[model samples]
Target: MSIAICIAAACLGAVLLLPACALARSATAAPASGIPATGVIGIEEGQLNADYWIRQQSKPDATILDPRAIAAQNKRLHELDASVHDIEHLPARLTRAQVREWIEAMSQPREETLYDERGEEIPAATLAALGDNLALDTIPAEQATRYGMVVRRADLRTFPTRLRVFNAKGDSDIDRFQESALFPGTPVAIVHASKDGKYWFVVSPLYAAWVEKDRIAEGAKAAIFDYTRKTPYLVVTGASARTVHTPEQPGVSDVQLEMGVRVPLLADWPSDKPVNGQHHYASHVIELPYRDDQGRLQFSPALLPRAADTSADYLPLTQANLVRQGFKFFGERYGWGHSYNTRDCSGFVSEIYRSFGVQLPRNTRDQAVSPAYNRIDLAEGLSHEERLKIVKTLEVGDLIYIPGHVMMVVGHEDGWPYVIHDTTGITFRDRTGELARVHLNGVSVTPLVPLLFNREQPTVDRITSIQRIRP
Candidate 1:
């Protein structure tokens, strides 16, 4: 049975259990648009793909995350990677003028307009204290840069504090300055620190933000960068995985590495060589970053058991494998800027493609309008039917861009396009024919046509573009 038909039939069964008056009212109710009432959409039987993903490893011909697919478009990918604000591609030395610029950009005190929990204005003294927390004058002058690596998944914050602030009370989410997150093993340049002597302002390949001092380890520039490009690395392809427990090396033991994180595999270690008394033969020897007693950067060896899910290399870049990889995060929570140990809309899609060695911008707007991809502009004065026509041809892994959001096309059912996206909310028609909004707050499946923008405007009427990463 079609998904819509199955859902309609299920609703019909619910009607059979309702009171007579409710049933009578339902008898004349306009049929639902066949969109699933809940955020979880069902996958059809034929959508299964364990075989393809499994075979791709043993049979190289079947792999999808092939860099060669876009090798000819290398220039485009380079441009996209360059667009990020990360320090990985920046110069090793900064002039005094540049240091001042970074300090000015990152260390300014906030304006005195603050609010209390009840949305009431806060006293001036409280605002001053908040400003005092930013020790801007402590910024250093010109210096040679030191390299660092994220030892753990760390929240990127606007300011150094763990405290959540808002323009008004009762608004706890977004945290105003929760920049993005830096996953484990992400390379960064240690540029500055907060005035309070707590947070480190480091720039990764994708973003620059204040991360907790304990979460990053500074190291030799050559050692840090070389470790990332070293051969025979294990790529963490799952949502997240950890090293096997090591009591001796608590600093690096069982550290969590998120999807697309790659760490070098210690090649050909003797069986007697062990990390924390565990024999190296049974596990992969991977180098992990950590901070020393004085809070400087250092590296250590840890063992990732053979059982932990990882790939010898990145998964190949192919549409079929995209669906399989994306589904691995099916129910992850929607975190803005990769907050709360979850990924938001753009972050979700980017991580999925990252497993296949693809790079994406940090936000929905950039990913949608990025010149690096094969984009179909919906703003070309096209009519409603014309836009729908373009949507019909959407392939698997195609990114559908509706303002403020992005969704990956898995496939279609009965001409209704289905999308897997990390989202906060979804809109669908209720049994009574009125639009209903459900807070998804996680990765979800939904049809593209019935989704409403702001629960009022049809997404179809306002779609800005449809982005396809593959040429």
Candidate 2:
């Protein structure tokens, strides 16, 4: 065994303990999954395939995420009043009564008073203006009877505009955010629109939010849903990739798509028809959407070079591939809720698994608590050493979840577990045994032991759950 895998035992025995609350559980329990199992360290690039999860989910009924669990969660969600940010597994078509319920939930002013960046309370007069501008009276419940599809990576903002807003001075976390992003080919029900008609309030299977009008295309109820399930599609496996540009159709040309976005290939496209003056066979001729002169969504064909970063199917869920896929975003700057033209912590992990056909909730809180994942409840009252021991057993793809953040276990070395995550900053001790801080405002790798949440609580102590997407 490599030094990394063998470091677990001696490492745990050496830690000096002082806290009483951390001693309730022992880390020595044989892992439920029999881990410390060898992972392929350097598989050839060509070998990344759907075979990754075959061994892990080998049991007859051992599936990926549990559908029965999701169905039950959806049933509970159905009872809650829907918000623009609430995730409800609603169908592609919502009945009129359902639409009215959604409208009522979204149209009213927020129950609590809102504050601006200056920490000044928003005056009641201003709140009234916001309410009036919401223009709830104009929501054409009769006209919004179809489905929609997002054709680009678009933000889901608190309000329907491109205006940038912040929480407070020195806090540029993009307060206009709604913890969700709609990627290409995501199906939605066209529920409502902004008064200005510039943004469409649509609902995905997991979330509902306002996406820019130009980024979405409304289609027939059946077509929008069918478009996503079509076979022979390619999933973007790289951080981001663009289609080969075609001057004749600039709208659909050079289109940019992020990781896990899937689009179907035009299987019947003839070889002789060249895109950008080259044989079409050399590229994956795929269908994409663009807005017509009438501002309605329409489909068009575009070319993505076969050599571009994509896959024939969702990558297999293997330890080696998990490491490989996680490294693809090694240096990307952390985007809060997909802000700063990049992805946030949850977005980073979500995209990695999406390339492998796994679906996850959009936020760390929900993901940590979701009943579908293979959850290792490390809630408080357990011994810290027991928690650290569980941390050591974490495999390459396991998600080590702290409140509001997540990290993927890439590997271990010298008794130190390394993680790659999208985070704003981290605190640790320097070689001189002095406290230090590093502003890692993007996706980065660091050891697990030295990390401190708020410079005091060991990250392990605050881990509410260690969620495994697949057993």
Candidate 3:
């Protein structure tokens, strides 16, 4: 027998038992014997467990020849089941009385419908689009329905509960650590979830440590508008040279730029720079000047002002790409008299910056000493909170300095630091050489430094304080 027929028979039986009672109130505000009327009642059956049911009757059918009518009905039933599963999972400590009380406090279920393979008898909103076409041709539109299904599937995934790291060597368990040990900006991947309802993540290549899911967003696929996983860019002539839309590829091509590159930094551009200067072009390198709101390029572009708590325009600098390129340019000979024998520290900084439309001074001390840069002054010691607040405000291409040297922190991987700098006579000799003239030039940090000054690290006073001049 159909559900409607069974319900009708039961109602008739009840009415026969007490005609006066039926006349008094047909719609009761309490749970009727063997039937629930108040609050959301869950229907459990065949893979359909603990589904919430709203007080909605099925809408009248539209099309006659539609084939998916049964499928549509089944889909609606499924949705109802999903909604109640989690609600029932609430602590068992609550008694039936408390459950009743909690149910009373809940909101009513909003009515909805479901869809099937054929567009007919299906909810209109569930229709899928193929390319520019709505695919209405596949499913007859004549069968569309007004009512939609309200199923409780899953909500957005929450922060991962657990995190750990392992060595990149053979993807084994040689050197593993907890997520907390990772430095800011260090790259890591979310591993499996924990039994205690937590998430786990780790740095890749190195397989470093697992961290909370809150620290890492699921890569590219999870991104909404700009679904780019990894964006590669070059720091040419102290400005951002070219941004490749794709992730982590070596050797940036000019041909790609001619085709029109996506401006990932559009949200953070000159605003991140300290000073605002007119864009200029000289030689092969372009001297793109950072501009502030006042039309000057004298402040650090890293400190670009932004509205508090807005997610839009939260573009990121590609760290994996920088690491790959930084290593690629590793063994090239260092250039002194020549403009491009190899990259010096300042030359490297200049090249990377020029590529992005920002210009920096030629030397570290000059770049460090420039008054045009944004000033984030700190003495010797401060708490991590105080230091991080200032660092969080920094953007790409920002300068980080220690006693006598400087480096750029691009971004973070597993919350660890990555830096790029050129040291004297430490140019790339060649690829895969035991020992060439090439020695240890400093490494470039992504999203750069997390702390410039702190109360614990008094050594910071000895080093030239970092100035953010890019706008």
Candidate 4:
């Protein structure tokens, strides 16, 4: 029987057992009031399980795209998307004008009023100092491009400073300076540096932003790319994993590896040898990036426990695997620009698909408009009913874009489509038709139809596009 029908039958039995007076009192009880204690609405208890959604798929195990197909799609993305860069193929030298353009583009003044952590408005002089810190005048007429690899997970900032700014007073969850993050061993081109010599303006495959100098190590382009291209790597399949804590090799010890991060495996290592004070038998030996005292790039062996959630290769792109991968991050805190050792909306979905060897743009705006994927662009003139019709047709793993946020379709229940997303909060119509707001502030699952983009519109009416990661 359907879930709705089962719920109706249970309610009927409960009503029949209640006393007449109790029933009369219950009838007048307050309308299905505030958001549930769990901060999730429209989700049945059973819907939380990956198996529940997997069972709903007609062909859960069917491959969405084979290895060759995924490779072709990635190549097409690198070619078509302006936001994605092919750093390995960049020119050896950069002109002053070229470097200036990159710096000026990202250093634009903010139109909105920004407040510091103390709730004080940022002074005009302070903003000007930040602009000066860009050191655009320092760019040489012709300079050799420097290459490097991220030695650790590092924050990508909008400006060279580490000052945190927010849109509103007392609201500090979203840091405007935080652009994105880079994983360990990710290759990059160091284009410029802050006047303070503290941060580098780097161009990574997915983003270009200011990263701390200590988190990256200067290296030869060939050596950096060679390390990234090494095969027989281990793919992180869990929400996150960490290397064994080691005082002997602190550079590679206790390092956090997020989902989809691939590290080259030391496949030929001797079985009897210990790695950083740990036995090789209990762990997988992997080569990790390290920064020397002189800030030069180096490699060291580290131990990733065999019990950690990892795979020898990318997981097969299948419907069941999509549900399983997404659920691995369920309830993780929403971290803007991958802050808090977690991820935001786009990062959440990108990492899940990355584990399957599929590549996507790093931000929602880029992913939604990219021509690399099959997309359904929703016109502003489309009626609400028309948009709902399109949403109902979305298959598992399809991405739904609504302005700044994106959600992955999990499954359908009682004719309503459910989605999983990392978000700050959700708004929906309560029993009395009054809009109720819930501060979810984390990865959550909710039905799509009842959600509100704001008090003025439903989420369906605000969808800008839907992207399908398929041929």
Tens-digit per-residue lDDT, 1-471, candidate 2: 111111110001111121221221222212342222111121223223323322333242223444454344444434442322332234444555666566555445555644566656657776565555555676554553567677777788755655444434444454543446777777777777777778777767667667788888777666666677787888899888888888877667778888888898788887778765657877898888776766666778888888889988777666666766787887787777787678888889988987777767777777777776678998689887787788877766788777677888766654556677786654443323333334456776656764444334666777789877664
For model 1, the run of ten residues with the poorest summed lDDT: 4-13
lDDT of each: 0.67, 0.63, 0.28, 0.82
In model 1, the Cα lDDT at residue 345 comes to 79
| Residue range 1-471, candidate 3, lDDT tens digits | 001100100111111332222222132223332222321111113211111110111221122112243234324333442221222123323343432222222212213332222322333332221111211123321221111110111111112211121222232221111111221122223223333323332322212222443433333212211222233322221111232121221111111121011222233244233222322121121111122333222211121122211112221223332233344344344332111223445555544433323334444544555554465655556654565555555443456655434566444334433344543311111112111121222222212322212212222233345665322
lDDT, model 3? 0.28
Q: Model 2 shows how many backbone clashes?
A: 4
| Superposed Cα deviation of residue 84, candidate 3 (Å) | 69
Off by over 4 Å in 1: 1-65, 70-75, 80-82, 85-89, 96-132, 167-171
Better of 2 and 3 by lDDT: 2
Regions of model 4 farther than 4 Å from truth: 1-31, 34-39
Sorted on TM-score, highest at the top, how do the candidates line up? 4, 1, 2, 3
User: Cα deviation of 203 in candidate 1 (Å)?
Assistant: 1.3
Tell how far residue 85 is off in model 3, in angstroms.
Answer: 71
lDDT of 4 by residue, 300-321 (tens): 9999999999999999999999
Error of 4 at 172 (Å): 1.3
Better of 2 and 3 by TM-score: 2
Please report how far candidate 3 places residue 458 from its true position, in Å.
Answer: 7.7
TM-score of each: 0.82, 0.76, 0.26, 0.92
Error of 3 at 179 (Å): 44
